[model samples]
Target: MAQPYADTIACIRKSTAEMRDLQRGAMDLDAPGTEARLEQTVRELQARVDEQQAALEQLRSSSHVDIQQVAYASGNPRDKLKQLRAVTAAYTGLTTVAPFLPSKDSMLPALLAARALQQNIRGTKQAIASAEAQITANGALLKQEESNLHDANLIEKALRDRTVRLEAQIEDRSQKAPAQLAKELIAAKRAEKKRHDEETQRLGDALNDFVDNYLSAMLAAEELGGPVVGDMLNVENETLAAGFTKKGKAKATKKLVSGKTRQRRIDQIWGSKIAVEEEEEAPLTEAEAADAEMRELIGILFKTLTGPGGGRAYHQLERDSAASRFLIRAKIAQFHPKDAQKLRLIDFGRELDD
Candidate 1:
């Protein structure tokens, strides 16, 4: 029977051969999983080689050394020969069982097999390295795409937020449109009406006051000098009262008076007297009248406070008293509220009787 060590070596040899065949098959197939399988097979074969080498070392340490002793101790020469032959046969069997058993260089077939295995492993490793590099590059590309998507999403969100805010502002402005326009129109109309009313009132007041003062002054003058005062004073009444003469009687009397006698009598009445010459009244031009009318219109429009008279009465009063120095100051103070405050004339000189 073959020694147990020989059987074990034979098993190792067979396993190694099988590993080599698997590596070759993997290379031929060149499938996706081939590289991984070939690498696994190479590792297993390397392990087996290590195990077989250890086994060989153990066998050489005891069994092989004792084989010679066993051969020598045999008594019969035939038995000794047979023992030697058995040892020799055992050695031969070990050699055949694993050609590369004693050392790595022992078998030509094993060396060739190992070399083929190494080449296959190297090729498999290179394929794995290439695959891993491609995978790494693909991962980088995926990360870049993800980053770009993130940036695009952020920009879209910001634009959406801005659009929302703009829409809200537009909606708010639209809602307020009618009310705002109405308010502005109402304010403008009110201002225009106020100005017109005030101007009308001022003109009415001025006209009324002017007429009243003029009539009063005329009456006072008449009261101061009676009808015959011109004869008593012996003054040239023609120059002093030309326009004031009565229509029928006064015109005839002035024509009957002799020219030289009239001159002498006028000189005797008042020699070198300062004569009050009536200023020639110039009629209002078109431009002046237009300006006056416009002023009246403005005053009528803007009279906020009611004056002494209603609108018409105030307009007349303003015209009549317009030239009176005292009344002008009073009217200015009355019309301008600021002037009234500065002058402290809130009550218009009205005092309560105690």
Candidate 2:
């Protein structure tokens, strides 16, 4: 029921629209404000570099202080060492100076100060270098984006012209008389319904097969004394675990309050059914939790199948090898919030040897 090129056409349309926006400089990347933002970033980085440079100059001035003269000026040994330590610590960024300390016998406060100043100067230069590199990278990216915007405009225009001509030709060739058109419409509707029915049946069969496999796996795990056997076996039956009865054909009946008539809502908009009232129940056990998760996943799959454009997507997945085995498994894992990482293709009973 789906056209083979539906996704491709949709992609082209989206790309063209984005290209049009880009050419108009309406997108964030190409907007007039983007340039202003870049300029602001450059100004901020430059200001930081200037601030660090000033700090560096102050540190250099402090490093040039005559520590040796200060230490010699102190007569007491203890006083000399204390002065040396004080002088070294007073230098900016030199408080973290380790492996170099003023001892009672020999104190080299000047060398400690010089090492700290060297580290600070190196760090300041590195920061400046990083900022400059980022600015250069940003300029290059902006140029590339601008060039791409021009190219995208050309491509978008060409594609629009081609698609318009092709669509016109298709429309001209597809015209039919009223009577014949009505007849063809009936046949097409029937065919599409048949396809839908077949896919639904297939999904139901897959669900049943999946339940069997799950039961089988649980049994096997039980035999092997696996860790989760108790949790898996806690549910009364596979039907209960799946939250539906086989005879009901996946329709779940809920008890309703007396004299009340109401429709029950399922997970999504398309899952409305007859319902009654709720009854108080105990909290879910580990087994019930797992069963609830499986029911939710099944509901999602059915919802996607019945949703708008879902038939086309499912048709693609059925026909395309790239979509069938790998993609279906991926979708299952993605939709399943719990045990996603633990899920395998075989668990769904869909993918075979190939």
User: Best-fitting candidate, measured by TM-score?
Assistant: 2
Q: Where does model 1 exceed 4 Å of error?
A: 1-108, 178-354
lDDT of 1 by residue, 1-354 (tens): 224544655565566667778766745665555555555556667887898889888887876456556736588899778878888898988776744333332233444676877886667556656655766677789889899999999999999999999999779767787889689779989999999989978977886565343322332122223233223232223432321345212232354545455444433332323132368354332222223333443344335224443322222232222222233343432333333221111233443111
Whole-model lDDT, model 2:
0.48
Q: What is the lDDT of residue 186 in candidate 2?
A: 92
Q: Please write out the lDDT profile of model 2 over residues 1-354, one tens digit for every residue.
A: 123334544565566556546545532445465566556655665776798799878876889766456646488889778887776677745656564233432223433554665576566556656655766677789889989999999999999999999999668557866787778779999999999999989987886575454533343222222333334553333323233233323223354222111111121211222122267343332233333334444554455555674332222121111112233444543312343232222224434322
- What is candidate 2's CA lDDT for residue 268? 22
Q: Local distance difference test, per candidate?
A: 0.49, 0.48
The alpha-carbon deviation from the true structure for residue 225 of candidate 2, after best TM-score superposition, in angstroms, is 14
- Which residue pairs in candidate 2 collide? 255-277, 256-276, 256-277
Model 2: weakest 10-residue lDDT segment is: 261-270
TM per model?
0.22, 0.26
Off by over 4 Å in 2: 1-136, 139-166, 173-175, 215-354
Tell me the deviation in Å of residue 34 in model 2.
56
Assess the local accuracy of residue 245 in candidate 1 as a C-alpha lDDT between 0 and 100: 41
